[model samples]
Target: MSSSGIWQPANDFRRVVFWRHGRTLWNAEQRFQGQADIELDDVGRAQADKAAALLAAVGPARLVSSDLRRAKATAQALADLTGLDISTDPRLRETYAGSWQGLTFEQIADDYPTDLLRWERDDISVRAGGGETRIEVAERMRDGVLEALSGVESGETLIVATHGGAARVAIARLMGLPYEYWGTLSGLSNCNWSVLQETGNARNPGAEGSWKLTEHNAGTLPEPQTEPVED
Candidate 1:
């Protein structure tokens, strides 16, 4: 114990389930929503309903969401099912696409080809439409996840409802990866979630504890394997 009588490196391990928002019209069109505040389409709402039913079965203790409309709507489904209040954080928002916000992939490729190329090359400093770089997105997202971790107790699950880009950056940052390696983790599909469990070690103590990826992009219930008898 420290002289201050506080637990070093925090008091407990935690579980974070990072949920990607359901589909939007732009998502179907392959347009980048970024921070555009697009709401969910009808199909998206249905996806959220089914996904929430499954997630609520696990009974997450806390719920935090990106302030964007699409994310909020998806989170709301879970909140409704679980009867848990929703907390919104702007830092959980997607990487801003800046000038590419409303443009299709082909449009951006034809017009802002240089920027798109840099982004595709994993240029951490490259901005899309003067929007945030991968590093900037990582830093802010790390802040939100860390803060969320600090607020929740050990063993309690924190359901973070955020965008695909933001969730990847946050998870990569928590996993202690350099910004360049963020691309190794695939973007989550709509209404899917990734799980990170805090597995702290008493042997080594730090303000931020270690996390493990127990699951990634899980959307459906698990299937039980049936054994063949009397072949």
Candidate 2:
């Protein structure tokens, strides 16, 4: 695992499990719920429960999540199953959608087509009214991931619950993918889980160790399920 400070991996450690929070009321409405703090829908709750079950099977050592309600709720479910404490960090929150919050894609396109188009083009500087720019979102998310990894020892596994946009940006930054292609990747399904591994020198890290995408869009659990929310 790469090290920027005193934290050194006991081994060539680098593995992270990225889980997208379950469906939300906004998600059901096909709206841009960035940083809006919406709760998960019933299906979303079920998704979180299923995610917890799957994660329990793998047994992660640590659990981290965005401070948003959706993400926190999802993390809690996993925490309950694995007996790991859930930690919240604002840096992991979803991309800020500014004035676009609660608006569906069709609405945004109808009202802010030019702005929407610019976003689609991956303009890092473009801001949707009160929303954050792509660059700003990327920086915060990078910091959050690094911070979360700092506390982990080499070979220790971590589970992070986050939003769709944030998850995409985080993975893009980690893999050194170009920002322009950020929107090209497949959208993470609600409650879907992805895995990444960290490796390399304690002082420096590279993506060369072993990074793989595990389960994606795994379905919901049965009744009385727990779920996650955005931070």
Candidate 3:
């Protein structure tokens, strides 16, 4: 925690594992979860168990997750494996779907045709159900992620369990990708993960704390991780 009672990110804590939560009934049905609190189905639980086993091998120093049941349950798998407690943050929750919360993709398309078309174009300004825009989601998610990183020890790895849309925003933000290019990054599948490593000297404020994307949407256990590109 920092002077403002928020996590102040530091350069020394560099490694990050972005884990997407396991599947849910809505997910299988193509329903938008948004900020809805939904639990994992049986297969989803099994997926978490398998993913946690793989992530544990990475020796994570901390575990952070969204408070949503799906994400919480997914993070619980890693917590059980690493014996590290879980820290939940509402900021890390999924994109607020607003009126689209429980609606299936087909329904959203049939009803909100204009909005659906805008979403397909990856327009950051388009708000589903008059909910959060991509920019808003990215900024809040970035804050939540940096805060979690600030709480970990130097050179330690942290696993962040969250939702698909939310995870992509965080990844794009960390990669320093421009807002317009946010559409270039796709969402992660259930139980898949990505890794981001910090590069450069801890003392160099600007040079330090830069991130590289080492892995993305990995379904199997990851091999020895490599450093992300130093930007």
The superposed Cα distance between candidate 1 and the true structure at residue 174, in angstroms, equals 0.5
- Candidate 2, residue 180: the lDDT equals 76
Tens digit per residue, CA lDDT, model 1, 83-173: 9999899999998888788787778889988988888666888987898988888789878877776667665778999988778777887
Please give the lDDT score at residue 102 for candidate 3: 88
- Between which residue pairs do clashes occur in model 1? 99-129
Per-residue C-alpha lDDT of model 2 across residues 1-231, encoded as one tens digit per residue:
222111223544666777889878888777888888888888878888876876776647788999999899889888888889998999988888888888788888899999888876778878865578877877788778778887777677788899877776676666566777666555567787566655333345434223434344343433222211212
Better of 1 and 2 by TM-score: 1
lDDT of 3 at 128: 67
Worst 10 residues of 3 by lDDT: 222-231
Query: Each model's TM-score, in the order given?
Result: 0.85, 0.83, 0.85
Q: In order, what lDDT does every prediction score?
A: 0.76, 0.71, 0.76
Off by over 4 Å in 3: 1-13, 201-209, 221-231
